[model samples]
Target: MTQTPTPATPVHWKVVIDTADPHAQADFWAAALRYVVEDNSALIGNLLGAGAVPAELVVESHGRRAWRDLVAVRHPDDPYDEASGTGRGRRLLFQRVPEPKTVKNRLHLDLHPGEGRREEELARLEDLGARVLRRVEEPSGGWIVMTDPEGNEFCLH
Candidate 1:
């Protein structure tokens, strides 16, 4: 007799992007996606008080303490770990790096702002420091490619 297979469980994950300024990227992405920047000030304070984290590794961001080399943005309605300020749902983590982006991205996000609203969304994104790379029109459909302030590519459909 053949045995039935068990259904696979979904894994929790976050996309990590390298950048010169993690904080700035986090801010930009948060605004662009209507997400919220995770506030880990309480966790940082606790770690500092316990001597688990060095003071030099923390910096003041938006009047609160954050990791000097990394930051994240998450959907506003997602659940998060209160103690760590980590999102349990959709999230994007930006890590600081010394090098700049010099080539095209292997992975990118495609945004759908609803039908008949692509132009409006594109304008809003442009106002947020994104630049139009090109526009693609095919018989099947079309989309507008854009680059964020840091040169990361994304699509508007």
Candidate 2:
């Protein structure tokens, strides 16, 4: 039999969040997921210098330059490009839009608080501005369905 080689592709994935305030969503999600907000200063600077982006469209966030219309959070341990300031691992990108969410999310994240700290973790999340939507139980287990300040759904399991 002949052997075949698998194609090599970078492990890349992003969660898109619809929000009226992308910066606020970035802050809330960064705290909730223990992730770091992407620092896009280098990229933004390059873009501005090259006439790709307008100066009015940039803002300072956490003492770093960021896009005014969108923001992202990335896994803290993931490798990132210091030059471009982009995460190479798990990331959540929040974008601003005028429309409100009208249906249940087709996809959501499950946060594993583990063992018996679910209530404490839930409280912590609430402190960070995540609202409890409901509690769901199943024969196997149960989880708390919650929404970020912007109303994006996530499950604490």
Candidate 3:
């Protein structure tokens, strides 16, 4: 019998969310997902020292330097680039946008805390600044639709 060839490695990518405040969104998401906020301060400092980036394009956040227009959060267990602080695995990047979110999201996250723990997870998320939009009860199952502080929609399961 011949063995089948293994498929190519999946591309590593990150989801990007547009927001008016990237750091705030990063903080909220980091808490909600039990993830870590990416620390790009060292990279920023290096760029600034080399005159590769303008001081006006950076900001002080969490007592450290950060990009004024973007920030990212990554799964706690994911590998990251030491030189750039960029995640090599699961990640979400939030970028500054001029306009606020005016419409429903074309893509949204569905969080599953565990079996029989939706209510507790919902409460925790609410305390983290998530607002419930509605609850859905279908014959198959149920879920609660929520929005983050920036109005990006997500669901709890």
> Which segments of candidate 2 are over 4 A away from where they belong?
1-3
Stretches off by above 4 angstroms in model 3 are 1-7
Model 2 weakest lDDT span, ten residues long:
9-18
lDDT of each: 0.95, 0.91, 0.95
Candidate 2 or 1, higher TM-score: 1
Q: At residue 120, what lDDT does model 1 achieve?
A: 94
What are the per-residue Cα lDDT tens digits for candidate 2 across 1-157? 9879788887678888888999999999899888999999999999999999899999999998899999989999999989988888899999989998888889899999789989999999999999999999999999999998877789999
lDDT of 3 at 109: 95
Instruction: For candidate 1, write residues 41-115 as lDDT tens digits.
Output: 999999999999899999999999999999999999999999999999999999999998999999999999999
> Candidate 3 lDDT, tens digit per residue, 11-104?
8889999999999999999999999999999999999999999999999999999999999999999999999898998899999989989888
Displacement of residue 128 (Cα, Å) in model 1 is 0.8
Error of 1 at 33 (Å): 0.5
Superposed model 1: Cα runs more than 4 Å off: 1-8
Kindly provide the TM-score of model 1 when superposed on the true structure, using C-alpha atoms.
0.94
